[model samples]
Every structure is written in structure tokens, then in C-alpha cells.
Target: MLLDTYGRIATDLRVSLTDRCNLRCTYCMPEEGLQWLGKPDLLTDDEIVRMVRIAVTLLGVKDVRFTGGEPLLRPGVVGIVERCAALEPRPRMSLTTNGIGLARTAAALRDAGLNRVNVSLDTLRPDVFQTLTRRKRHDDVIRGLEAARDAGLTPVKVNTVLMRGINDDEAPELLQWALDHGYELRFIEQMPLDAQHGWQRDDMVTADEILTSLGGRFTLTPEPDAARGHAPAERWLVDGGPARVGVIASVTRPFCRACDRTRLTADGQIRNCLFAREESDLRGPLRDGAGDEEMAELWKKAMWGKKAGSGLDDPVAFQQPERPMSAIGG
Candidate 1:
């Protein structure tokens, strides 16, 4: 197994299929639209599959998550999912989507071997939704979530980014909605990924505030395993029903101490830290006819170099990377 010096096993891989997205979220991309990675710069389906195989076989990876500016925008997303599902041990595969095009592809993705889906829906209010996403398809996203449920994507997760002055007030309402609809609602604290937009710590809403607002009506049971990987979410289940709620406290409560995730860009560069500028390019070597064993060694070296924590709290030490969240594949 690929073990890092910090004793973190490299088991989960988050792949960004493309940097292009339909919606220009206020917190993600610029209002004027942003430049996207070139076609040749992004890894092809075959290359992505090759990398996944290496990760699974050599690193003991048991889970694979597809993400992007919007992974659904990828031409052969279903095909990729199908390939991942066909692996020997068949890792638990999932996808993170904006839910804009989900209504059309939910069934195809489910049939292609997707275990679950997480939809980004910041606000329930139409105006707020448009304001947050810079798109007027709030209803479309809602329908997409329903379609996912109908397609048998159990425990459909709704990811809500809680920006203090933006959508923090709607936390209780969102949790109640998720509980009613049987969707796992997750509230994520905003981070400083988009350096161009000028992220501020004061704008964040802590997890404590969110739990306190629940009024102690439901008992919160923590799921320790949820903190095992790069999953920033701290999971908990409500008293009744199968409904669960999670909080991704990146800002107020960092999970860097137990982070077991490593990301691969669409172009095949392995990133140890999302906020770090360093990356090991795997696409070039793979294309240059590097053998599987050689690639495995390269991966081991990269994994062994992982730091103890992201150190996002250190102002002098923490210098934000150039890539935005869209390019980095949240």
C-alpha cells in the first residue's frame, strides 16, 4: 500500500474530468467568466483510467470520486464511471456535481456504476440561488436532485457553502429540508481557495454556530470514519430516520491533521495540498511510455513527500496557489 511518512494511506483519489463548467458561481469563478484549461492540457479518458488503476493496485485505493468545474460536462463521464466500476475490487465510486445537467444523466451515471452523488445547492431561494451561482436554473437543480433520488441514488447529498452574510441564515431551513426529503445536507465553511476573489476569515460561519442553531432538538452522533479521507465533512445522523447531516469546517475547524486525500488534476498532476503550488506531473511520463512499475515508484515518492498538515492558518507560510476551485476540482 502507498503509505505516506505521516502514516496516511493514499486510498481515495479525486479526479477532475474538466475545468469547464456551465454555471459561474460567485465564489468559484469570476463574473466575467474565466479561462479554462486547454483540451490537450487535460488528461484523456484512457489516461485517467490508467492513473486510477495505478492508484488502486499500488496505493490500495478503495474509493474514487469524480469532480470538476462540473464533471457532468465531461463528454464520456458515464464511460469513465463504468470503467472505474469494472475494476477488480471495484472501489466505491462517487461524483460531485453542480446538478445543472444531472436531470439528463442521473440514470446513465447510476447505471454506469456511480454509488452516490453530491449536489451543490447553496440556497433554496431563487434570487439567492441566482445570485450565488450566477445562473437562473435553481428549479433545474432542484429537479436534478429529485431525479437523482428517483434514479436510486440513495442518500443524495446536498452541499451548501455557508457564507456568513450570504446564506448562513438559511442553515436551519436547509437542514430541515434535507431531513424532510431524506437528503444528507452538508454545510461547508468557506476557504481561501480563490485568491483573486479575496477570501476573508470573518465571512465564515463556524460549525458550532450551525449546531447551536439546531436548538438541541436532535442528537448529533459523529461518524469517525468520515474524517479518514480528504472528505472535509464531519458526519452526524439525526435522531430519527436515515437522514444524516455533515459539516465541512475547513476554516474554523481544520481536518488537516487526519487528511488522507490526494488529488489528481485532469492533466494528471498529483497534488498533495489543494492550496500548495507544488505538483508532480504524471501525464508527461505516462505519455513518454513509462511502465506501470515505474509509474508506481513515482507515485510512492510523491505520496511519501506529503506534509503533516496544509498549514492554511499560517499567514506567512500559507501562500495561495494560482489555480481556482474550478480548476482544482473541489
Candidate 2:
């Protein structure tokens, strides 16, 4: 197990396939985009699979999520999912995509052993979508979500980030839309992860504000903490019953004590925390002919030094990581 001195064990792994994305969301990057990873710097497909193999077989990682600047943009992404799915004591697998190409590949991805998908979508309005993402592909994202659901990607989750004076007013409408479509809606607070370093605490929409907005339209009953267990989102039963909504208050309500996730960058560096300042290089040693046990040891050591919290609580002391959310594999 990837155990830390704080008595936390990391069983979930987020592997960034590439730092390249098709959309330039204002919250994520500049419109022109940051410099992408050189092909030589990215881990090869084999290396990625081998690392996952070690984590699942040796380190007890039970859940694997492939993220990226946009994971669907990665070449042979389906093949990577297929390879990872073949491991013994198979881990549950999912993808976090911007949903640009998902319509065309969701079925293939599902067939390739991907369990489900979490698509990033901020608004249902086309003009607002374009403004937020700097892309005119709102229709494509809708098509992609439909494709994901139709392809048997059960419990298709939608990840939405509300920016103040932007799409923050659409929370209730978004949740209502999600419930009508059988998709799980998760509203996340905007964090200081943008490349522009322009995020302000006042500019972010808090979880309380979201629930308050929804309260005007519907009743929300909180789900028990046991049901949430290590999950980032604190859920609520909408209008009472099976259908529920979630809010990931990473900023206002940090869930660090029960954190069970470890991250691997596209370049094969281990990130024990999303807001971490340092990374452990596994690619260097892997390319140097390191064995499975050695690689696993490196991963364990990285998690062993995991931070107690994301440190976003202290405004003065908390420094944003040099890498943006895209580069750091949000």
C-alpha cells in the first residue's frame, strides 16, 4: 500500500496521459495555450501500462482514472485502457475528458474496458460555453455526453466549475438538467490552478452558494458521510430520493484527512498531492532499466511524503504550484 506517515493509504491513481488539450478553458489555460510536453518527455504507452501494473499488482491501487489536458486527445488512448484493463485483480477504470472527441470514441472506450467517464462542462448555453472554454463546441460536448450514456458508461458524471460573474448563476439549472438526463452532477469550486494565476477567493463560487442557489429551485438533503467515504464530493439527495447532486468544495471544505488519491504526471512524475510543490521522477529510472519492485518502491516513497493538506486554507502562505492544472493533471 502507498502509506504515508499521516496514516493515509492511496488506493486511487490519476495518470495523466498527455498535457495536450483541444480546448482552452479560461479557468485552465491561456487561449494560446501553454507549451505542451515534447513527445520525448511523455511516457510511452508501455511505460504508462507498466507503472499502472505495478501500482495495481504491488502497491494496492484499486481505482485508476486517466486524466489529461484532455485524455481523449492522447494517441491510442483506447489501447492504453485496454492494456490496463488486462491486469490481474483488475482495477476500476475511468476517463476524465473535455468531451470533444468522446462522441466518436465513447463506445470504443467502453468496449476497451473503461468503466465510465467524467466530462467537464460548465454551462448548457452555447454562448456561455464558448465564452468559458474559448471554443464553439457546446454541441459536441452534448453529443459526447449522450454518446457516453448510450454507450453504457453508467452513471456518467458531469464536472462543472462555477466562476463568479460567469456561469455561477446556472447551478440550479445545470443540476436540473443533469437530473433530467440521468447524469450525476458535481459542482466544483474554482481553485487557484489556472495558468494565468488570476484566481481570487472572492471570484470563486462556494459550495454554500451553490446549495443556496439550488435551494431556491429544489430541496437538497445531505447524504451521510459513510456514503461519501474518501470521495471529494459531498452529495445531497435532490427532492429526496435516488437522484442526487454533489459539490466538491476543494477550497471551502478540504477533504485532506481522508484523501486516498495519488497522481502521476504525463512525464511520469509522481504527485502525492494536487497542490504539491514537488514531484518524484519515475520516468528517469524506468528508462534506466529499473525493475518493477524498484519502481513500486519509488512510488511508495513518494506517497509516504504526502502533505497533510492542500494548504489552500491560508491565503498568505499558500502558493500556487508552478504547474497549472493542465500540466499537473487535474
Candidate 3:
């Protein structure tokens, strides 16, 4: 198991398929986008599948989430998912995408053994969406969400980041839209992951403010702490019934102590934490003909040195990761 000295075993693996994205979300990257990985730097389908197989069959990863600069942009994503599905003791599979091309691929991805999806959709208004993502493909995201639901991606999750003045006012409306559309909604506090390194704590929409804004329109009952487990999102029963909502307060209420996730960059570097300043290279050894056991031991050693927390509370000590959310595969 990928157990750290802090005793947090990482069973959830987030693999970045590429450092490429179609949309330029203001919080992720600049409008012109950042320098992308060279083709040779990215892991091929076989390499990705092999790593995932080792994580599941060898390191005991129970869940595998394919992330990216935008995973839908990966050419062999479907085939990759299909191959990973064939592994012994198959792990649960999902994707975190920007929802641009998902409209056309949802059904195919479902058939490829992808269990579900977590799409990024900040607002229901096209104008606001365009402003936030700096893309006019708002309708495409809507279509993608509808397609995922139609394709039987149960409990389709919508990840919304509430920026202070940008789309913070849409919190209630976003939740209402998700509820009406039968999608699970999660509000994530904006962290210091932007490429511009322009994140300001005062400008962020905290979890408390989110609940307060939504309280004006709907009632939210807190879900039990035990029910949260290692998940980052602290959930709530929306209106005291079947429908529910979640808030991932990474800035204010960090969940580092229970983090079970380990990230693999598009170039195959192991990131024990999202805000980690260091990485362990797996691609180099793999291309050098390292065996599976050797690579797995390297991964184990990386996790064993993970820090206890992200250190966000100490502004002076908490330096923004050199790599932005795009390169880091949020």
C-alpha cells in the first residue's frame, strides 16, 4: 500500500492523461494557455494502462480517476479506459473533464467501463460561463452534462468553483440547476493553484459563505462527519431529503490528514499531494526498462514522504506550487 509516515494510505490514484486543455478557465491558466508537454513527454496508452494496472493489482488502489488539462482532449482515452477495465480486481474508473467533447463521447466512454464523471460547470448562464472559462462553449458543457446523464453516468457530479466576484452570486442558482437536472453538485473553495499565482484569500468564496448564500434560497443539513471518510467534499442533505450538495473547503478546512489520493502527472511524476513542491519520476525508470516491482517501490517511497498538511494556513510558508492547476491535473 502507498502509506505515508502520517499513516494515510493512498488508494485513490489521479492520473493526468495530458497537459492540454481546450478551455482557458481564469482560475486554471492564462487565456493564451501555458506551455504544454511535448508529445514524447506524455505517457502512451500502454504506459498509462500498465501504471494503472500496477497501482490496482500491486499497490492496492481501489479507485482510478483519469484527469487532464482536459482528459477529453486525449485521443486514446476510450481505449485506455477499456484496457484498464480489463485488469484483474478492476478498480472503479471515472474522469474529471471540462465537458467540451464529452457530448459526443459520453456513451462510448460508458461502454468503455468508465463508471461516472465529474464535469466542471460554474454557471448556468452562457455569458457568465464564457467570462469564467474565456470560452463560448457553454452550450457544449450543457450538452455534455445532458449526454452523461443520458448515457447512464449515475450521480453525475458537477464541480463548481466559487470565485469572489466572478460567479459567486450564482451559488444558489447553480445548486438549483444541478438539483433540477438530477446531478450531484459540489462547491470547491478556490485555492492557490492558478497559473498566474494571483490567488488572494480575501477574494475567495469560502465554504461558509457558500452555505450562507444558499441558505437564503434553500435549507442545507450537514451530513455526518463519519460519512465523509477520505473524501474532500463535506456533504449536506439538501432540503433534508434525497437531493444533496457538497463543499470541498480546501482553503479553510483542509482534509490533508485523511487524503487518500496520489497524483501522477502527464509525464509520469508521482505527486503525493496536490500542492507538493517535489515529484518522483516514474517515466524515466519505466523507459529505462525498470520492472513493475521497482517502479511500485519508487511510488511507495514517494508517498511515505508526503507532508502532513498543505500548509495553506501559514500564508508566508505556503508557496503556490510552481505548476498550476492545469499542469498538476486538478
Candidate 4:
């Protein structure tokens, strides 16, 4: 098992397949998106599969999550899922998507051994969705959700990033919708990932406020979280349905203490922390003929340097390396 200096086991790995996405979500991307990662810098599918194998076989990684500016944007993403699923003791494989392309790829993804998917949909209102994403794809996203369900992606999860004046009022409505459709709904507190994106603490809607707004309409039971990684969300089940809800209080109640996730960007850099300024580049070494053993050593060096946790709430927080959240695979 690869344990970092802070004693956090490397059990979960989030790999970004690409830095390109189809939507321009206000929270994630700027109106004018940042420059994209050059093709030469991005890791090939073979390289990604090799790295994932090493992570699961040598590093004791138990779960593998595929993310991206939009993972579905990556050609042959289903092939990557197939390779990850073939591991000796198959690691739990999942994907996080914007759900724009799920309508066409959900079945293929499930057949390729993807265990689950988490879709990002911040609002149910078409105008609100357009306002938040700068695109009118609310109906498309909804269709993607239904398609995923029809494809046997049960308990499909919808992730909503709640901003104070933007979509906070729709919290109860979203929760009710999730319950009605047997989907898992999660409300995430906004974070300060992009300074240019106007992330303000004052604009965040705390998890407590979200729970209070529900107002005993449904009994909230804390679900058992025996998983090893730090997801930050305190999960609960809404009574009278198979649906569930989660609250990710990143801004108000940080879960850095138990953070066990390591992100591998599409360009092959390992990020020990989301807010970290330092990243160890593996793409250059891999492309230049580095063997798996050599790459494994580099991985250790990066993991060993991880801080106990990121103090993002600190008034004196340092500037994150200029990589936008899209490039970092959120």
C-alpha cells in the first residue's frame, strides 16, 4: 500500500482523460475558456491504462474514477474503462460527467465495466441552467439522465453546486425531484478554485442551510460510510424512496483531514491536493521511455510530499498553480 507522509492511503485515483469539455459552466470555466492543453502534452490511452494498472497493482488503489473537462469527450474512453475493470481484484470503476453526451454513451460505458456515473446538473429550470452554463442544454442533460437510467445506471447521481443567489432556492425542488426519480442528489458548497471565476465565500450556501431548508419533509438518515477515501459529503437517505442525498461542505466544513484522493491530470501530472501549487509531471518521463518501475518511483516521490491537508480556508492561502479546474479535472 502506498501511504503518504500524512499516513493517508492512496486508495482512490481520479484520472482526467482530456481537458476539453462541451459546456461552459460558470463555476468551472471562464466565459472565455482558458487555453487548452496541447495534444503532445496529454497522455495517451495506453499510458493512462499502464499508470492505472500500476496504481491498482503496486499502490493498493481500490477505486478508480474517470473525470475530465468531460471524460466522455475522450475517444475510446470505454476502452479505458474496460482495461481498468480487468484488474486482478477489480477496482471499483466510476465516471464523473457533465451528462451532455451520456445519452449516446451510457450503455457503452456500462458494458465497458463502468460501475456508476455522477452527472453535474445545478438547476432544473431551463433558463437557470442556461444562465449557469452559458448554454441551453438543460433538456439535453435531463435526457442524458434518463438515458443513463434506462441503460441500467441505477440510482444515478446528480451533482449540484449551490451558490447563494443562483440555485440555492431550487435545493428543495432538486431534492424532491431526486426522490421522485430515485436518483441520488448532491449539493456541493462552492469553492475558490478559480480566482477569475468570481468564487466568494459570501456567495456559498452552507450544507446546514441546505438541510434546514428541507425542513423535515423527509427523514434524513446518515448512511454508513465505510469507504476509505475522503469524499467530504455526509450522505443521507430520504425516507419513502430509494433515492439519497449528499452534502459536500468543502468551503464550510472541509474534509482535508481524511483526503485520500490523488488526481492524475490528462497531461500526466500527479496532483496530491486540489489546491496544491506543486504537481509532478509524469508525461514527459513516460513519453521519453520511462519504464513502469521508474514511473512508480516518481509517483512515490509525489505522494510522499503531500501535506496533511490543504488549508484552503486560511486567509493567507497561497495562489493555486495557474491551472484552471477544467485542466485539473475538477
32-52, model 2: which lDDT tens digit per residue?
948889999999999999999
Predicted structure 4: lDDT: 0.84
Cα lDDT of model 4 by residue, 1-330, tens digit: 666877887788999999888888887877784788898788989999999998988888889989998999999899999988898789998889999999999999999898888999999899988988999888889989998988887668888987678788888899889877768898888767763757766677888999988755777877777632467788877773355688988767778878878889999999998888889998888888988788888998888899876776674764545677788876
Compute each candidate's TM-score over C-alphas. 0.94, 0.99, 0.99, 0.94
- For each candidate, the alpha-carbon lDDT, in order, equals 0.84, 0.94, 0.92, 0.84
How do these models rank on lDDT, best leading? 2, 3, 4, 1
Ranking by TM-score: 2, 3, 4, 1
For model 3 the TM-score comes to: 0.99
Off by over 4 Å in 3: none
lDDT of 2 at 110: 94
Off by over 4 Å in 2: none
- Model 1, position 126, has a per-residue lDDT of 95
| Residue 327 CA displacement from its true place in model 4, Å | 0.7
Q: How many collisions per candidate?
A: 0, 0, 0, 0
Error of 3 at 143 (Å): 0.3
The lDDT leader among the candidates is 2
At residue 6, candidate 2 shows an lDDT of 98
Question: Over 4 Å off in model 1, which ranges?
Answer: 216-231, 240-242
> Candidate 4: which stretches are off by over 4 Å?
195-197, 224-229, 240-242
